[model samples]
Structure formats: structure tokens, C-alpha cells
Target: MPASLSKGGAARLALLLFLSLIVLVFAVASATAIGDYNIALTTVFLSVTNELGLTGADIPPIEQSVVWNLRLSRALIAALAGAGLALCGAILQALLRNALAEPFVLGVSAGASTGAVCVIVLGIGAGSLSLSLGAFAGAFAAFGLVALLSNGATSGPNHTILAGVAASQLFNALTSYIVTTSGNAQQARDVMFWLLGSFGGVRWPDFQLLLVVVLFALAVCILMARSLDAFTFGDEDAASLGVPVARIRLVLFAVTALLTATIVSMVGAIGFVGLVVPHAARYVVGPMHLRLLPASALTGAIFMVVADIVSRIIATQQTVPIGVVTALVGVPFFAIILYRARPQA
Candidate 1:
């Protein structure tokens, strides 16, 4: 859908996407096969088929349980989370006209962290509230504050970014205060770990919820792809081209918020996937939103699934947080982006 892409370019793009999907499938299968117990790929396939009722190959109960109840769900969730975050990053970058824009830039992650800590440390909701729900509320609360500070979606990009910084600091401080003052040592430890991100506890339910959210968000973004392309030329240019800048900005921002909040609540604010994946995807797919969005999602999915696999085996008898793995990769890429984005001498 890129205006500049010719027939040859389209063929290349299609091939690239096809290959990416193949790699993603392989990465996911690898994830399901390479845990502590290390099931074979054949067993993994049969276990999956067995669960789908597509085949009735007899498998050991424990191995089947590990694949079905544990690794498969975690891998799928990682893929979805990656795809969702990358999509949000792409959306924010175009709307804000900033190459560095990412989901956490709006302070959503910080707010989710504060909300989660409140649930865990303060026993909020009198034992009725789930951590995910609390974090969701907190994330939206941060979005609300940023919206107010920046005078809603119509504010200049710089103003919105500044508001996001303020909101992040405020929520981060609140999280620290609650953890330090109210939570006991064990509670503090738990809260800290969750904030670093994990796929350890996710199951089919989390995957299902995220699949729906990510699919819906991707569909919405694809529908608005042309408007997003218009926005890259600045709001006035978009308006001149008959794009409804204000309404589109509001809708896209809300969509990003929905995605960021949902993911943070589920996985504890994994970083750099959103920041790094979109840029890499743009390089491969060019700057068109139509191609860029799905490409970014696919790249993000592969990146995260691989990251999850790396996290599992990086240390002897220990699991690194998925966030930590992403940070390790993203920080160098972040510096490269910054260096390239520096003002020309």
C-alpha cells in the first residue's frame, strides 16, 4: 500500500512478510520445545494437535501438560504482547511525528505499575480486585492526567511528551512510596519482580484476552492507515488533504492506550520492543502504515518469542525477566537511533 512501491517492490514485500510469518511460527514452536524439560519438536506438534483434537497421538501426561498448560500459552502470549506493543509504537510514532515515540512514552507503564503495587501492597478493593484490573485503572488514570496536562490530543507533540514525563515521575514516585511504606519485605520483593515483567504465570485466559484486543486494535489501525500516512506530513498538511486530524488523533491515541494498558497489566511493562521493533520494521517494509503496521507486529512477535526463549536458558537454573532481555537488545538499538537522529552538523 505504500505509494512509492512498484510491482517489483510489492512482490518483495509479500515475500518478506511470508518469510517473517514462517520464522515466527518456527520461533514459537522452538519456544514450546526448549524449556527445562526440553520436549522434542515432534512431541510439541503432537501435543498441540492433541489439544486441538486434530490427532489422537498418545503422549506422556507430564510432557503434554507442560506443552499445553505451560509453554504454548506463554509463547502465544509473548507473541501477542510483542505484536501489540509494536503496533502501539508505530501508531504513536506517526501520530506524534517522533521517531522515538513508544507506548511507555505516555507514562502508561508507570501508571500500571503503581496500580499493580496498590493491589499487591495495600490490599486495595478489600481483596476483590485483580492486579490486572487495578493496573488497567492506573494506566488509564495516567493517560487521563497526561490528556489534561497537554490539553487533550490537540496539543503539540512536545507538550504531550513533557506531560507524559511528569505523569511517569508522579506515578513512579507513588509506586515507590507505597512499596516502601506499606508493604512488608516479601510484598516489596514480589512487587519489584512483577514490575520487571514476566511470562511465568500467564495461561490460556491471558492469551485469549490479548488475542482479541490485539486483533481488534490491528484491524482498527489498518482501517485508518491512510489517515496515519497523512499525519506524517504534520497536522495542517493532513487537514489540507481532507484528513480529520483531531478526531483521528484522539481515536489512535485511545487505541494505543488500550493496547499499552492491557499489555502492561498482563506482563509488567516490558520495554524496548515497542521502541525498537517499529524502526526495524520500517526499514524492511518502508514507511507506509499499511505495510508497516503488520510488518512491525510480525517482527515484534518474533522478537519477543525469541526473547522469551533466551530468558529461559540464559542462566543456569534461573529465568531472566523478559523485560531484561528486551532491554539488553533495545538499549544498543536505542543508542543507534539517537545517534542517527542527532542534528546534522
Candidate 2:
């Protein structure tokens, strides 16, 4: 690399870091001050402190349970889901040569949601492990359909998304038939909120598991940044340049499926993070995949955390669904981008 280009990269990185910090401070402050659904941000922070034995005053075990087991778990889970979605979307857009591509565009989320509903509505998950396994299977099925339809990597962008759409419609139809045919009022309620998505009812073990999964996904995204950058020049071009296109695509898809399934099983099908955050990050950092990947990951984590905070605070005594909050935030931004994007030459 030229000396000037190296210097330019450093300057841009510094600017990204400074901007990210400002966003983080605002997110922490907003999360700390806003109140409504149940507890204020200060209370949430103090509760965390109390759990860690860092608080000056002694609080009851119940208080610790409430903060650590429920709220904090939800916050972290939201962050994990967001980061995973955004990271995957960043990879997919480059790989597919499709600007409209997103992590869920291939119906992985729909398939996972279908599988989860089967468990929730059918009393299938005897344990948490079963739930995760089931969701992963469903996500894998969705991706499998895509791969097969594409004839093991010969398929184009539209063909893959089309395959995903067809599979999703089938899953949705099955899900609807199952729900309607079962005629179980109790199960219907579970399915409804699961689709709406919330961080409620989490435990300490689940929280730890979410943290580990997210860290692993983040690591993979960082390591694969070079491969993603290779994708910018188009697949054939990259291949001529000695990039192993098929191998990299397979690896990315598997990692994304794993990450997406892990989150779906835990947090349900929260929307917009994967679809919105990557684009926003690109707007911030331009189209350098190496930087874009990590930048998107951070942007997504913060985006969901803030959205979750707002969801908790928007209503008195009742929490809004985080999915709804995400859609509310993402839609307008998406529209603006669509309007502003230039025509491809």
C-alpha cells in the first residue's frame, strides 16, 4: 500500500473510533436515564452493580435476580442478535452482488421462527438445548434450499432469494396450518409474543451463552474481513485474483446460519438489526469490507441496545416489543437511502 493510503486509512479509523464513542456514551446515558416500562437506567446500572457486589448498599437477592437474570440478559441478548444480523448482512451484500440482500432475505429467520413455533406450540422442547438445536436445524434447512436451488454455488442472487422466498412461504403456510388446526388458545399466545419478540423471561445461564455465541461470531466476522473485501470486485474477478470464492462463501453462510439460529432460539425473531445496521455502518465508513465488518458489528450492537431501552421506556407498565421498535427506527432510514442512492453506471 502507498504511504498516503496508509495514512488515510489511519485517519478514517480514528474518525470512526471517535464517532463510535460518542454514540456509545449517548446510548449508555439514554439507557440510564429513561424510565417507564419498569425500571430506570440508573436502577438498571445499580442493579448490575449490586449483582456484582460493587454497590455500596446491600440489596436483596430478589433485586439481584431481577436485574441480572431478566433485564441485563435481555439487553445483552438484543445486542448479540443485532451484531450478528448486521455482520451477516455485510457479508451477504458483498457475496451476492445484491444491494438489497440482508441476513434474513433468504428466509432463514422465517424458517427458524417456524421451527421455534413448532416447539413452543407443540410442547416439543423438553429443554433449552432442544430449542437451540431445533432453530439451528430450521436455519440450516433454509440455507440448504438456497444452496440446492443454486446448484451448489452456480445460482445467481435472484435465484437464491427466490428459493428462499418459496421456502419461507411454505414454512409460513405450515406454521399457520399447525396453529389453526391445533386450536390451542394457550399456544397461540406464546406464538404471538414470540414473533413480536422480547427479551423477557431470560435466565443467567442463557445470558452467558448469548455472550459466548456473540463473541465467537464477532471473531469470525473479523477474521473473514479480507475475504469479504475480495468480494467487492465481483466473484469471477476475485476468483481470477486467486480468491477461493466457493470456500469463503460456504464458510460465511455456515457461520451466519449458526449465529442467526443461536439468537433466534433465544431472543425470537427481532427485526431490522441485520437489515438496517450494516447499511448505516457502510454510510459511516464507505465500502471497505475489512473496516465495514467490525464497524457494522459495533453499530448493530449499539442500535439494538438503544432500541431495547426505548422499548422498555415508551410505555408505562407495559413494554413495547423490541421488534416493533426496530422496524420503527429502520424503515425511515431505509427509505431515505433508497431515495438517495445513485443509479449504477
Candidate 3:
């Protein structure tokens, strides 16, 4: 697809984005309402509106508290995490020209988990380094390792995927070793649950932080959308077309690291939003980054909020790890991609 959209295409994209926004709002509300203690959908709306000072509707204090204090934050964070991951996946797919490129597949999420464990268990930097910062460093480290193993960005998709698998195993094992050797039983339990992914510990502060990171990253990516479109062809083609290939790649890699690290720090290492959402978005919006980035963000937000809801209800009185829910959906999608990409007989 061309970087620029035709007039009719642009109008269709706008309509799609507008409709997706509405769906995202509904998805978030549904997520907020369908927890262990059910809150009515109307109550969910009034609770949110009341908090915003938009209405003075009478709502039960407990319902209000749950909606405003707990579920709302989690839903918002889930939305942001999904959007961020999807954006990372879209950007990476373009930069690498590989459909399977994403944070989870690239081992960025595992690397971030290892870094977070370093802070929580080993107390890396002795109380100076924040978990997000540590994860950012570790994410980049993993990226660097993959780059080395695959012989830089020019490596074939199979080689890159192999490098990512190696990185994931290495970081996951390191995380386990650190917890087992340094952490107590209680800490071990907490770390293990977190590594698998959870939204239970998040609050408004987390939502606020993630909101900023995701929105800022989206804006940056949007501005670079044309460059990303150029990248889909090849680095040589991109360079020939006046794109500064090296700088754009570095900046985008940094953005991806920042997003993956922040999300892993806050919500643990959730997977597959990055892998699955972008492809789905591209199906809807076509492959232009200008349209695809926002489409991915909206689609991702909806997908994750729905996943979070499933995690709550899938077990009797127990919340499955959000990662597990995503993996269930993602693993099938992953297999499909692999089969489709397989060489013809």
C-alpha cells in the first residue's frame, strides 16, 4: 500500500477510527463492570461520570469505590498496555519487515521481567533505579543481544525469531534463578504471579503514568508514520528515498523499549497484544502506518479489555493471569501465522 491514502480511503479510515473509539469505550466499561462483584453497567457509567464531576447521580458508595478506585484504573492500564504493545508491534513489523516482530516474540517482555526482578529481589542500584528504568535497560540489552545473534537488522526472519527465543529463555531463567536464590517464599510467590502478568496491584497512579507513556509514544509514532511506511520496502529502498534509516531505526527501537519496559514494570510481562493486534488492525485499516497506528491502538485496547474480562470469569472465583488469557488467544494466532508463512510444498 502507498503511504498516502486516497480520498475515499481516508474517509473510510476516519469512520473506522471513530467507530473503534466507541467500541473501546464500551469495552472498558464492560471490563469495569464484570469483575468478581458485579457492578451494573449503568452504575459503571454513573460512577465514572460522577468521578469526573459530570453528574450527581446517586450510586452505592461501594460500587462507586470499586469502579473509580480499582477496576477503572486496571481497565485503563490494560487499554494503554494493549495500545502500547500494538504500536510497538506495528513499528517493529515495519522496521524489521517481518510479520512476527513484537515485544513478546522478540524477548523484550522477558528481558523487562528479568530487570524488574533484579530491582525487587536483588535491589539493583541499591534503591536508586526505578523498576521502569531497570526494565528499559534490560529491554535494550535483550534487543542488543538479538541484534548481535542475528548479525544485525539485516538478518532473515527465521534467524531473528531464533535469537528472540534464545533471549526469552535466557531472561526467564535468570529471573527464576534470582527469585529462587534471593527471594523468600512470599516474595517468590508474588514475583511468580507478577511474571505471568496481573492487574490486581495497579492503581490510578499506574494508569496516569502509563497513559502519558502510551499517548506520547503514539504521537511520536504517528509523526514518523511515513518513515515507517518507507521502511516496509527495505532499508536500501528507504535510504534511497531520503529516509535516514539508521537514526529512525534507533529512535523507534528506543520507543519500543520505553513502552515495553513501562508496561512490564507496571503490569508484568503480558504477551501477544503486540503480536496479534497489529495484524488484525492491518486487516481492517490496510497497511499505511498513518491509519494503521491508530487502528492498532484502538483494536489493541478493545482486545485487551475483553481479555481482562475473560480472565476474571474463566475460573470460578479465581482470576487467571492476564498473560495466560492472551497466550491462549495468541498461541493459536501464532500457529496460523507460521503455517501461512510456511514455504509452499
Candidate 4:
């Protein structure tokens, strides 16, 4: 755990993540082409090379369908969701100046969950992306509350934390009331399932939606990373260093909330990818968002992929939600982190 070795490890992890993205892209392609889950990485490599302007022959129709129609989209969507959530956690941690700060932990996820449940139970979503829209509304409302509470002379990380705690409790109460009042077992189960999160039942079209959001969110985060880095020295120091702390936070918070809402709608509120992946990345990678952003994204992508594999392998026909698996796996890992934890940017 020497400083030099930590840097080297991070560099190695970054490289591995870069390669993994390429590998995942190829794997998704092969999965689509063959219509089976047994395709190995080598086949995927050949398929991708052929697709690129590299040295390979024309891919057959089956291969094309596999790569373009089915597996590719689903896998990419999962990657995007994982990456987006991790970045969201990283940004929130910085803003709140608390390691535990995350959409789920701070009640943003709870608020979104409540809004989504209302639509599901009351049939208010009507159809379309109503669930997602409701979640976004809930997330924004929570962010607004936090913003309001953090705007005064007494505002600070602690204030935001307190406000977020209150918001979380309020949202959960509302959600419980709705589920209980409805008195339908099915509705109650749906609400509970969503709260735990998942990426079950995803398809190509859904993946397409995921792609648009992930890219947009990541682009914004990269643009904002430098300012986030400024926050390492505290808000006053960041302000002195030319950062409009409040303004930047508002923008990033909105973006993160939107990203979270979109992913929640699509994947059903997968947690810990954001909360754990960034901390994991930060352990090996430096805290600089320039490095941290991509590392967190890549790490999260790999982590979720692996988690999905675990969920799939351990299932009883019905695939376990990826979110549940992540928490079960993350609890031990996070416990270790807490035992040996220290402050870092």
C-alpha cells in the first residue's frame, strides 16, 4: 500500500477497465450473433475486428443481429447504468463532504421510489416513461429541498446532511403509506422490488435510451470534475480558487439527479454501484476526477457486469435483482473499507 504502488495499481486498473470495455463490446456482439450465452471472448474479438476497419471478412447475418440487435444494446445499457451511478455517488460525496453521501443513502432514491410507486399504484403514469418522469420529479424535489436548506448563512455539509436525512425519512413514510393503503399484495411487492433495484428484463431499445443518458451525464461530469476537485479543500477554499461553488453544485446536482432518475426508471433503482464503485476506484485510482471519472465509470461497469453474472449464475430461474446482489456483496467489502478508512479528496 505504498504511495507509489497505489499509483501503479490505479494505472493498471485503468488499463484493465479500458480493455474490459472493448471486451464487453465484443462479448455483447457475439451474444447477439449466436443467440447463445456461451460465446467466448476470442469469438467476440474476431467479430469486433471484422466490424472495425481491421482485418476480417464480412460478418454473417446472425452475427450482425447478435451484435447490433440484442446483446450489444443490453450490455452497454448495463455498463452505462453502472458508470452513471458511480459518478453520481462520487460527485455527491464531494458535495456533501461525507463518504456516505449517495442518492440512495441521502433519500434522493427514496423520493424517486415514492414518486414511481404513486404512478404504479394509482395508474397515474398512464403509460410511456411515466415511471421515469415521476422518479425524476421526485429526485428534483429532493434536490430542491437540499438546495433550499443549504442556501443560508448556516448552510454547510452538515446542514445538507441533516436536510437529506429528513427528506429520506419523509419520502419513505409517504411510500409506505401508499403501499399499505392500497392493500394490494402485488402493488406492495412491486414497490419493494423497485426499492431494492434491478436490471432485469432489459432489451435493445431500453439499452438505446440508457446510452443517450450515460453519455450526456458523463460528459457533464467530466466538464465539472475540476470544480469537484476544488471541493476537496472545502467550500471556502474552492470559492477562493475561482469556483462558483453553489452554482456548480446546482448544475451537477441536477445532472446527477436526472441521471439517477433515468437509470432508476430503466433498471429499477440499482444501488451501491454508485455508493461502492467510486470508493473502490478511489482506493486505487487518485482522487482527481480526471482520472477518477473514467476509472469510476470503468470500474463500475466491470463491477456491475460481474455482479450481473453472479446474479444470473445464482438464480432460481428468476434472476435476482442486480441491486440486491451488489448490496449483499458490497456489505462485506464496505465493512473492510470502514475499518481502515481515512480521509482523501
For this target, which candidate reaches the highest lDDT against the unseen true structure? Answer: 1
In candidate 1, what are the lDDT values of residues 1-345, reduced to their tens digit? Answer: 556567887788789989999999999999999988899999999999999999999999999999999999999999999999999999999988999999999999999999999899998975688999999999999999999999997888788889999999999999999998999999987897888899998999999999999999999999999999999999899999999888898888889999999999998989999999999999978899888999999999999999999999999888998889999999999999999999999
Query: What TM-score against the true fold does each predicted structure earn?
Result: 0.97, 0.87, 0.90, 0.81
RMSD values, in order shown: 1.3, 3.1, 2.7, 5.1
Worst 10 residues of 4 by lDDT: 27-36
* lDDT of all predictions: 0.93, 0.74, 0.87, 0.73
- Candidate numbers sorted by TM-score from highest down: 1, 3, 2, 4
Per-residue lDDT of model 2, residues 1-345, tens digit only: 423237779678778867876776567445544444345556666777766778755555665565566556566666667777888788788877776677777777788877877776665665664665676677778777767766666555667678877877877787788788873898887787777777776566776787787788778867767667777777888888787887877777777777777777777778777768888889878787767877888788788889878888787778887888988987887787677786877
Residue-level lDDT of model 4, residues 117-191, one tens digit each, is 888887775776577678777776776776676673236778877877888888889888988897399878877
lDDT of 2: 0.74
Candidate 4: count of backbone clashes, pairs at least 3 residues apart or interchain: 2
Assess candidate 4 and give its lDDT. Answer: 0.73
Q: Is 2 or 3 the stronger prediction by lDDT?
A: 3
Top candidate on TM-score is: 1
Error of 4 at 118 (Å): 1.1
Q: Single out the weakest 10-residue window by summed lDDT for candidate 2.
A: 29-38
Could you tally the backbone clashes for each prediction? 0, 1, 0, 2
TM-score of 3: 0.90
TM-score-better candidate, 2 vs 4: 2
